[model samples]
Target: MEDINTPSTTGLMDRPAGPDYRLGAIPLAPERFSTWKERLAQWRALRDAPLYLEDGRARAARGAERHAKRRLSVHHATQYGHVFSNKRIPRDVQAAAMGRFEADLIALTPRRVLVLEVKNWSGQLKVAGDRWVQVQRSGAEVTHPNLLAHNREKLRALHRYLAHAGVNIPAERFHQAVIFVNPRLEIDPAIADHPAVLCMDDVGDVLGSGTSLGRHMAARLVQLLTDAETNATLAENLLKVIPPTEVAAATAAIKGLRTWDRLTLRGGRELQGDIIWLRLTGNQAPAAALKPGGAASLEWRRGVIGGIQWVLRNRGAGNLRGDIFWDQHLVPGRRVPLDADDCVYFHEPGEPKPSIIALSHVERLQIG
Candidate 1:
């Protein structure tokens, strides 16, 4: 692992120094176009007499997200991992999915993948059967869907996406929580005692070395993933599922384009060069498939004298499988691999020979 002494990483943790406590936050891209003119709005709209710039609940939600992230960054947690903020499902993946799910934040560690949904609502909150009701200061009441159930669906969708990309981790290894970020919020005792519902101050207890009502919640978290994978392996696999543009944006945020690539090795060595590609091997196939005209005709069946029933049948088909050689590259060239060596080849600007490092030793590769 690379040293955590660098300025870029030191400020991320608020607790006293601990060995191997490395953490990083990936930066998201800013908005591209600001004004309607820049976006080339319709002539009729642009010609309107007055322009409207309003902020409602959206502004409050954004503020709460900022507050939650800030508190999380400084929390005295012993776990080391990367936190992805405002993670959006890629457009291509969303097209085939039923709903547009967005995670407020995703905390990924070797042992646990935690999905956090932050809510900034401030009021007297109560659980009414399957829904939640909020009593505002102005004597107004608002009803909201069950956030706990909604976040659970998001977690399941995330698992589906990862499994589709060949990174199959046990569902037990994933966890979800709904964090109320507003300090002014008041929650009913019945619902606040829930395991998945938490307030801002409870974050450290659930995530790391802290306790909730005499319970070692952090230790309990470890029990959820008895047989966990290595940090590097999970990171590499997760990178495959994440879009390349987002990866590039994260690289730019961590360290500017000072080099073509930054290779962080598990042995604490950092190298600068052009990372051509990564050599990964796996097999992929659809779970099942159907052949053309595989449906059987419907038939009517009669029970002794009770009723008539229609039966529909289908002919099962075989699965189509293929080997996957995913070698993602920084600079484009031949996409296919010529050999089976699982190593990363790095080349300096004017170096005659490329440095070959075994894939297992590399911790992370950041593209410039």
Candidate 2:
């Protein structure tokens, strides 16, 4: 297990404090999907096969490459789980040929958008101008792809993709990092000194350092990535059946509906909707005639523009009659007109007091 200790920084944005406020998790091991395992097996089988077997060698190389990527992906999940796990933006996205470049991981923080390239090579590595060389354990030397050059192309393609999707992230805000996942690997002093190149251990310290503004920027970046990922997932689920214009309009409408004051209760429960019901735990009566049962219901209905009809109902035994005071105020028999942001409370007469159980709101209405 890799431990990442983030240094406390000043200027972080004010946010909710608690365990639930965290964005991601760190897993001890890389996730091994069936596809990755299959590729690994294929690579191992053909790696030392006949030299004349060109197709086998090529397949083996691809397998090795994918296996390395998988290992790095796992390492990253463990090392940066707190910052990246369960984030809105999907990591390790494989682009189609049309995208021109595939990314190992795309991380969006408040300050910048990071495109990471994971290289899991062992032994000694050196870079001379545009050339990258790797020396194996058996004293064998080989030239590998120029990761920086390759990532540059990927960055350009990503920009184009974002532009086409109507995202307006500036190029200056886009950054890149090449992570060498192998712990046993050694790098030439010149290449290791480069800012963009990092070993697995250095990732946490670098990202965790800096001022409060940097931390806030990271948080915002995470949000943007998450939103982008959500939109992409929605688009995929819709199968592109809906036109982009209509989809954008519908999305905007949904966002508008969510802009209401949320009701937070004891035990960390929250309710935000047009209709909320509170079930009391004990017997409470507003009046002698009205024997209150253990439940109170609140309803909000839209009337004229921003006007709200706030209705409160008390469930009790026998024929109910007369009005009762709700929160030291006269309760209307029908509905009380109030502002959208008005707060309401329910009181019960016994131990283990009243609590909000359910909330229901109209998100959308479909018309044929």
Candidate 3:
């Protein structure tokens, strides 16, 4: 817990000493995921096949090379698409190509491989244009396969070099891709038949395909990509649960703290202890109804563009109006008494409240 010194709010009774807040820190472990963790640990162990002569050194060099190439590829991609025509190769273009080049050179990858090539270009494609072309809907043209061809040749060259150094991988298993990064792009008919080229939308599907290389191999691949012992191990260990959705699923369990809670409101006050209801209105501001425990307090902050003027309850019956504030920044939890501009009220389900669309989704507090 910490203190917020908003002392200027009336130097009396230490105003901001209301709530104790702390970030949630949950310790996640592979043991929590049941059988998945063990299964992956076994897979990762297989990646250290000890097939290469200088296994450690080879992995490091390959990772560094790949990282450099990726950097260049991204840089160059930024400069593409314009009428530059690859003239002197703009600085960004050079960077993007370099990244691609490095990606081609890195051979310390695990089993599940994704060969990605990115391109940015605009111009109507055709059924045939020099080396590559393709037909499109509405009878338009696309770009040539020349760009793809160049990338393929480069990849093959790098592959050959690595193979001679003792690494052996089949062509089909390697995977090849030509990415069209440009939002506005056209593919020529020739490129259509080119097994390497793929549209952007399908890229994720393609990358996610295959056996996932289990857990062991994925870790080694991460190692090869990062060129470090710790990162590789960390990436490997995380495979137990894989993260992202897992994190969401794990944390969402906490929301159940208030799942079965209930509350009701009438007029401008609350009848239920757990829930609070009140009506408030003012001259020039947005009106809001709040239940003390349920709807919480009016969260309108001072100096803010808009202010919540009042809390609303069963309207036509009471026409309730009370409390108003002109400011920005809500108090913690928007807590406020009934008198000040920031007051709270409550309402029973389906009760006549404000027509504000957002009011329907309000969270009610729990009180037994």
Best-performing candidate as measured by lDDT: 1
Show model 1 residue runs off by greater than 4 Å: 1-51, 74-79, 89-97, 209-368
Report the Cα lDDT for residue 257, model 3.
19
lDDT of each: 0.49, 0.40, 0.33
Per-residue lDDT over 178-277 for candidate 2, one digit per residue giving the tens place of the 0 to 100 score: 8776677899877788788886566543343222443334444444555665544443343222223323433332222111223333232333222223
Question: lDDT of candidate 2?
Answer: 0.40
**TM-score list, all predictions:** 0.43, 0.34, 0.27
Task: Say which prediction, candidate 1 or candidate 2, comes out ahead on lDDT.
Answer: 1
lDDT of 1 by residue, 279-338 (tens): 333222121221211111111111211111111111111111222112223314322221
Candidate 3: tens digits of C-alpha lDDT, residues 1-368 = 34555454655765333111111221122222234344233223222111212244334434544443454334322221111111011113325454223232211122222335554444445445455553444456544556565665554644444344333334443345665544455655566556666665554343432224355455545555664445434553565312222122212321111211232221122222212432233222222232212323222212112111221111111112222222322444333322122123333334554221111112233332
- In model 2, the number of clashes is 10
Displacement of residue 174 (Cα, Å) in model 3 is: 2.1
After TM-score superposition, the amount by which residue 9's alpha carbon in candidate 3 deviates from its true location, in angstroms, is 56
**Span of 10 residues, lowest total lDDT, candidate 2:** 359-368
Q: Output the number of the TM-score-best candidate.
A: 1
